[model samples]
Target chain A: MSTGAKKRIMREYGECMSDTPPGMKITFDEQNMTEWEILLDGPEQSVYAGGHFKLKLTFPNEYPFKPPVVSFKTKIYHPNVSNDDKGSMCLGLLRPEEWKPPNKVVAVLRLIQTLLIEPNPDDAIEPSIANEYKENRKEFDKTAKDWVKRYAK
Target chain B: MDPAGQHRDMMYCHECHDEWYRDEHGLTCPECGSDFTEIIEEDHDPRDHDDDDDDSMPDLEDHHPQHPLHHHDPFQPADDPEEGDISRLQWRQVGPGRFSVTGTVYRTVSPHGQGRDDGGANALGGFASILNNMIGGAARGQPAPEDAVHRFSYTSSARLAPRDAINPQAHMEPVDEMTNVLVGLMATFGEAPGGPNAQHPHGHPPHANGPGGGQMPFHPILALLNGMRPGNGTMGDFVYSQEGLDRIISQLMEQTQSSNAPGPASQQEIDALVRKPVTTEMLGSEGRADCSICMEEVNIGEEVTELPCHHWFHHPCVAAWLAEHDTCPHCRQGISKHERPSNTADGNTGASGVNNHGQMPGSFAMGDGPANDATLVQENWENSGSSQQDSSSGGIGDRIRRGLFGPPHR
Candidate 1:
């Protein structure tokens, strides 16, 4: 029996393929449903605007029940995202307790967009960006946009 | 990635083509005595991202942020100076029993630009405007409070149908457009999305997809419970009746009681959660801290539950949350990640004992069954064994060689 996840994922895939979310495009092997490569366009209003960020979303077998592991594939300067080999962004809903099984990949995509627009300094993975974001807005925006141009582009 | 696979602890051996639970059995292939094996974490395809590396990537550690002041450990000096509110949560009660929970949630979707101004405004905006004519239901002993009443009963379809059915708000809310599409798949298989509720393992496909909505499944029990009401008094009336409330309370109590058993989270595991007494310093300088559930500010000294993953939340919020699921709300990493294997005595379940009808519990006879599956193996063994026997068996050839060289060495 394909659990709720299999059917739900197919539905998500169809909807996303049919109506791609703003600034987000997903590509996955038809046979391999669990791992998907997402091409994310930076929010227009943000410093990272005009950049296309590459991200990989990998769902566990117990998806919905468990949050998908989303990581940045393209390098970009963001406060919430870890700038490392892992490139894992510490988003909240993907957090175990916050992850309602009903939540979809679409919501996660929305979250990434929101994070790009307004990075939270409190729970930042990259504190320097957060500090700069809090104390020096100009430098932060310039560096973020610079990284967007240099790497995310 | 193998989406269907649940167990991440599996290690596949190439030499013998055997699979071992890496958690139970250490990193060796027991059957063939080989060390070559690949670790698979829940069957996710080995990451292709590891291959791509750009040297231009900035120096990460130098740019990384650090939380230096008041690391927020459960045990800290109580007399620490409070800091500014850095958490992006603004809890504003719009009306009685209704409020817009706006915050920079882990995954969020609120119209942007509400900004930090709402906090100062909400503090002074309550009291006189706390719903001037508050609904008289569930008054909670206090004639009225300055703020809006927030009491509520959480219900799912698995519990009851009737009076709650009249509740347009409750029941059969599709999770998303995708859930609607999946419902079509379920319908093709002929399963009613929620007929008889919990009995349907792979849920009864919700018949009404409508156009779009949250796809949280509706339990069929909602109808059955409502059907039990006397006469044809309508499902709406019965849903709001005291009996309905009683039923919901009883269900809630039963669920809470069940938590003592090995449910989503074990009692011991839940107990291990850090009971950090809410303090001023933890909330920072602003006296507003975000709870894991509501994403609202928790008051100082309000006890919170901290998961092993280090995510903390209001005690009540986390209690209600943990009742449904086990993992830490924020990290998805298990609050109780280390689930003790049931049968630790015989962790190594070998390929040989897989088909045996009544084998000993821990006795996994290795290298017996799979090794003998083909006749080609016997032929090869016989051929190699005979050839080795002729040279090193030391029967006649070794004796002659020893006789010729007997006095030579001396």
Candidate 2:
């Protein structure tokens, strides 16, 4: 990593440790400085209320300048989240052009929490789920809760 | 002036090369339904003439509306091509006859918008018409009037009247679009017995359009830009848009800004940095072995500059840094105490004096070297805080005092 990136990462790591987000915990990989493990318990108000989801965030050498890559390791059913082996979650803020230097991992965690609470059905990667959420809200909640109970227990 | 039987607007289909009334089929051709219909206004549409002589057209469909069977009004005015989208119309017809065909090498470099409606009074006189006809010559680069460009897309095309066709000579004004085009071409390529184009400026043409002809006529470029690129056009015709003009200018500004930021360091500044010949004996256990900037080990017999902060680096590397910042890259220590201007030198004193809880200026400047005038300045710099008040010309001692106390306020 470049000196600027390394210094900023250490600073960001220090800041994130000081104040962890609500219902979320951040843990760094012992050997790799760039990789971080986030254990996120779904908000009580959301569909996946009692679910515990594990997520991985790997930052490039140019953090702040380049946005980190976020993917769900735990199985989940949601719109905007791609249903694939990569389990990549696409957020507007995480886009390369939109990612700013000042945004930290805590901000990303907050966005992910709010995204689960109020899913955007319009710009969805999983169009089937988005359609279900829009047209039939009851069926979408039932399917989402079922997936959380089966896989994210 | 007779409106009846005049072809107001015509759509020329690119696929079938058929003309249509825009009001009937809209933007596309009715026969082919092709949207690539170039708006055209023919004076006496040859199709209208072809209808008069049925032998000229081989139409198998007896009930075709375009035929005399389903007779339509020919004199109806054509709808505006750019009616809904006026901003979509990129170029404006400046004064006509500005853009002349310079041989076959015709190219427009930039856009200009001026004198758009002013040129119709002196319009295309005969002498200018002769020059408009002359084409085959080497063309020079000229500033294109930005008032309009590629204007042939959306303009009121003059359709031929039945009366004008019967008596063509009666309405053949020098400024007429047809005569402007014909005379411009004649002035451009018509190098014959009465080669008015080749001889008008040289006063070699006949008496009618001689030296005392009319006002010097504008070229076809300014007079009639429609003659430049006559063809079928779509919505994307205006490529050099006004919005694109700003992008070109911003790119130019960015190029100049980057050039000024890091002006190449002068050779003399590189040679003048306080340096010492590197030796194996000087490698102290307390000091770092490698240069922080390049991260290279200090080789024996190589010259090095140990800054006032006790941090040593390669002479080439540190001198290159000091030329711009005048500070140590690793420790943020001052390289030269009095090198900068009175204002910035005061700022540096702020950093140096406050480095260790804002106590000592002596330890910063006189780190490892022998005592000199620099040491004496640091000794009294603290007491003589207002150096300007102490002396009229501001002596070294008074300046040193200002430097000492300047850090606290900063």
Candidate 3:
């Protein structure tokens, strides 16, 4: 929580404010800017079109040096996101080694939107979901849509 | 044998070498009045375990697996030993089964010495092999136990001094003290190098010092002990091959990076980076941009460091990140091996307002397609939802979608 880290978080917040991702709304608190609550409406091209999903983005003390953590609070049924209480997504730039300091929250939001459009089954945290997505696309779609209705409504 | 119901707890004074049962006198040693006294918890002396027939060498058998001397693969790569695990004992191969150990002394008198301290164990192994050779490789016609440290459980009771408290003056005394301890260990553990009764200071059965054998066995040990003394470079570097040692050291350092994070860059590398003031081209279209590291707006004339990749940030800002990792914060290209001017033309892309977030597709690679900045996508939606923008950067937004998922699945 150095001043540099705080200033960076504040600046990222300002940038995220002006250009929030499509179908997404960000809620920020001045007191605890480290944790951001995001409300996302599932995109039209994806299976979860009508679903409203709540997500949490938490920044570590290392800030740009380390990647921000992204978790699904609304428990979406997806291959890349973990299927548990943590609901963490650790693939792509979300990974510590893959993350770069110049990458912004807008890029992260875009990644999430892109992931929803077509989940990356190859680098998946949920193997069963990935297997279903690869081997039985119909079943994966049915279950994903069903969960979006059940939890994300 | 005092009173049947009376508890007998023996106490030994490390300073004066006085032994008395604790019940008769308090913690203070009545003989020497030294506060440096240890309560010897075990009733039977450690030497008592030694007298138990050599046929049952259970103690050595129990601890042999953990000992470094019994290491299955000496040349196999190993992680750096934990700090303070062992001090300066180096095992150099002299012949088939022999090793000449060389280093300035290690004392295992502290409580932390309970676990795998390789120095003391190695010294014991050295003694075991040397004794095994001298006694015709057989203990009075029986094959000797390979490691004899089991007979001496004194590692627990030897409270000479804590490791941190050892003064320079006390250094010489420990070698002499360790010599006596080793001598006692040789007598108790091995086939008595000085005959059975010679070492028993309490004067037990077989009577003391039969002949010249008393001092004869001690010469080699004294020489070995003298070699172990601090600043004793007389032994020289016993390692036969420098390449083999270097390989081992390098392997140790490699294994030390067990975690995914790479080590920090040198300060000189961070210092040598080129610096320049913010210019109009370095700022966004609105003439405003921030150092991504510190996220502070870089006004014109404000100093910034330009990495080898031409991606720049506040001097202190980039330096901090480089200290933790050498790679450019924008591109993952390492500062040490950056491709010269390959992408320098597009390097100002970081300050190029809308597209800065779109660049650095390399950082987002994870089998799936890389992340493209959403600002372009937002612009295309604003321009017209379905019609593609004819601009080159606008064309990238359509490519971003196709790249993210397979070409236009919908």
Native contacts retained, all candidates in order:
0.00, 0.00, 0.45
What tens digits encode model 2's per-residue C-alpha lDDT throughout B1-410? 11357655655666666765666677778888777667654343344433444543465334334543253322221111122322332322333333212122121212222222223212222323333345333221112222112222222222221111001122321112433333333332212223323333434342232322222333534333322223122222221334543454445434533321122334564565558766544453333244433334455666676654444566755665556543343323333333222232233455343332212222222222222223333442332233223222223223222222221222
RMSD of 2: 25.2
Q: Compose the digit string of candidate 3's lDDT tens values, residues B1-410.
A: 33457668777666666667888898998998999887765343432333244433345345323544565443332211222433444544444333334332321222223332345344444544454554354322111122111222222111122111001212312212323333333433333434343343334343332221222222333423332332222222212245644554445434533322334668987888878877766665455666766767677887887775556788887888888876566543446542334243343422342333322121121111212454433332222212112211222233334434434454
Using TM-score as the yardstick, the better of models 2 and 3 is 3
Chain A vs. true chain A, TM-score per model, equals 0.93, 0.95, 0.98
Arrange candidates by lDDT, descending. Answer: 3, 2, 1
TM-score of chain A of 1: 0.93
How many pairs collide in each candidate, listed in order? 30, 30, 0
Please, what are the lDDT tens digits per residue for candidate 2 over residues A11-104?
6676568666678888886578788889899899999899999998888765644578888988888886888877787654565433434345
DockQ by candidate, in order: 0.01, 0.01, 0.18
TM-score of each: 0.31, 0.32, 0.45
Model 2 chain A: worst 10 consecutive residues (lDDT sum): A95-104
Cand. 2 Cα-lDDT: 0.46
- TM (B chain), model 2: 0.23
Candidate number with greatest DockQ: 3
lDDT of 1 by residue, B67-162 (tens): 453244423211111122113434444433333222221111112212213222232222112322232221111111111111112121222212
RMSD of each candidate?
42.0, 25.2, 26.1
lDDT of candidate 3 vs native? 0.55
